[model samples]
Target: MMTALLLFWPALAALLVLLVKGQGAKRVAFIAALVEFAIALFAATTFVVAKTAPQFELSVPWVERAGISFSIGMDGISLLMVLLTTFLVPLIVLSSFKHDYKKPNAFYALILFMQTGLIGVFVAQDAFLFYFFWEVALIPVYFISAIWGGARRVAVTFKFFVYTIFGSFFMLAAFIYLYFQTPATGIAPHSSDINAFYQLALDTNTQSWIFWFLFLAFAIKMPVFPFHTWQPDTYTEAPAQATMLLSGIMLKMGIYGVLRWLLPVVPSGASQWLDVVLVLSIIGIIYASVIAIRQRDLKRLIAYSSIAHVGLISAGIFSLTEQGLQGGVIQMLSHGINVVGLFFIIDIIFSRTKTREILSLGGITQTTPALSICFMILMLGSVALPLTNGFVGEFLLLSGVFQYNYVFGAVAGITIILGAVYMLRMFQGVMFGTRSPETEVFADLTFNEKAVLIPLVIMVFWIGLFPSTFLDISEPAVFNLLNIIQKR
Candidate 1:
């Protein structure tokens, strides 16, 4: 029952938000998001970490003849992902209060609608259902970017749409193929249940091809390396709220997909391609970090930095070490929190100074100590400063990768150095030196902005100080997944 509520509540709220008029929609959407977050927190209380199987399970026949079910549930992983979604969303919506976009109702409504798609993807246990929600999640964000984005919104959004859709088709093909491979049962010859796919024992060759099919889909979403061409543009072009949704939550769908579906479902094929994928992930870490250092646009730099952070997460996951997987899991939460805060800070700077160019702004710290302090904390977290969230996850991830291969681990470690370089450079450039003309009268964070950032700042420390709170929740699930891979 709770699973169903978590899945559908955002959608219902979206409809309610649509009914609202004028700026009331912002309040309606925000309250609705808060209610959804409250429900998720309550649900978390009931989640038993000791149980490895999904709790609050709900399965109903969706296409009886075709062996499809409207199935969803929460394990440690799904719950954490849901928590991330619910937690970040209200902040994302609240952050939008500063900007009264045209058709505020529609803007807020789409955000709520996107939340449903995101939640559905996390909780979905059926392959078809996961795919359904995956596509559903994309639609609102696409519209959000295309309709509300910067001048290049059309071209940038279209490229993003094309990339994702192309990837989706590949994923669908992989799912259909996997569905056909499932054991014949009842009226249908195959099933789309995630467990059924997990139980499949495909030959090496078949698994190899299917691996690429699915990897292409997830890689594009994660925008791993060569396939990441569309990301920076989309992130830059989208509105701040839209960018938050994409970076903080949307991109995690791919990472979640890799953990939940790709690695476990195709372990043999994954093993076959392990080195290749790791190399790509490591390259992205270096490539993106280097690019970020040269970037003048604050938003674009953060966008590239996201690619680097995600690269490490991907590497950790594919390494298949206990530490690596756990690190990946915890890092997902940490990255989401830190990145959203960074982007929100960037948005605040852009809103006030009317510019995001590093050269075009400075000395904000002198005028806006609060903004400077918040930005510094979030930036430090991004660079993995000890006692911050980024450090815990990155430490474990690097350890995991090191366990896999010292050379690769060593290469991946450069992210920390480069990360610090770019982040510190960005911070120093924006907050210090002489004030640019645009930032001469920069104001401090407003009440609503403080409300949005304070919680994120708190989380940066919460996860940093005691990662075990989250690591414990995901440990059992990670072990269970690893056991499945080993057995096969």
Candidate 2:
């Protein structure tokens, strides 16, 4: 329950700040996000110190008959995700300070509310509670993009909502089916606990249907391949800070769902459909990579790249091996940090120059050396350079795929080379070559900007260089998931 407060405190802080006015409102929001970040850090530290296992912990039952409870707990996997969410929120809030926003208090308040939803999604141990949090998280982001996004905000925001809901309904249906199937419901209806879900044995036919239903929802959220049409518009239209949250933390909600709900609850179904998932993921990676190479807008290019990266993650998960799951989890974290860093640089450039068109931009390194250097490192990481965070995850993932099938591994391996082509081309065009007149007077990184990015840059290198430390934390949980899948 105390862990739950880590989610609520931010909203509570936001309410307090609403009473203040103007710039102070922004400061209050930044402070509130900082406070929440601290609490998350505390929770992470405490969980590790206590040497906790997943506990059926909650303060009280929220809706007893529905099996809905205010339950929340963490395995190593969930805790890492919770930490990532909290870690990024404050940085996002602080980064927004430089922009002149309308109704600063509300903007900050919404961000806090968003945090509550995100944490709720990660920690939720109950299916009904999880779905409730899923919708809750979506709402705040809708407002964030609608109120704070760029020129086409309305259409982009609406598409974002509709696109997610279109997929989410499938998830909702699957859960409803499972809820009724629970023998406790027949004995005398009970709640919908996710942990309880792990124990039930569904017929293969049912598992097959439920698996697709659940996967559809998660895949739409991940926006893999054919389903990814909505991403570019939304990412390009949303404000940079909003984009960071979307790409960095929000997208992980999809991966988390696959881990928390899809894998454990429907292993038989997942195994049956593994090849189908692997095919879609590979297509998305290659398809998006090719498209990204031709992109004119920087944000759009990155958006496509995000789709590709998550595609690989999806493929890794479907591999269904211990190594695959571990790679997927580590890759999720690494992608979150590295992609967010890339987008932050995108935000920095857009904030100063007011355009995302790659053709319109030129050699920024001439003036923004530090910014260029940072972007280059992040780009290299994106391309999975040997010492960067990306390499370790890709290496593990491809290894896992190879174990599954050599053809699968070889096809997935092509992304490593293609990724470099698009990323370096984008990098060389924007950061290196001759300066465009439009960027001629560009200023270097500000103290505030550096403050936001330095930590992310450190993470890129740290994870790249010392992956074992991070991978070790996730091993136990990953092993648990693999065992569940194998048993099924």
lDDT of 2 by residue, 241-349 (tens): 7888889888899999998899889888887888889999999999999999999889999999999899888888788777778888888888888888888888888
How well does candidate 2 match the true structure in TM-score terms?
0.96
The residue ranges of model 1 lying beyond 4 angstroms of the native Cα positions read none
> Per-model C-alpha lDDT, please?
0.94, 0.84
* lDDT top scorer: 1
Worst 10 residues of 2 by lDDT: 48-57
Residue 360 in model 1: shift from native, Å? 0.8
* Model 1 poorest 10 in a row by lDDT: 181-190
- TM-scores of all predicted structures: 0.99, 0.96
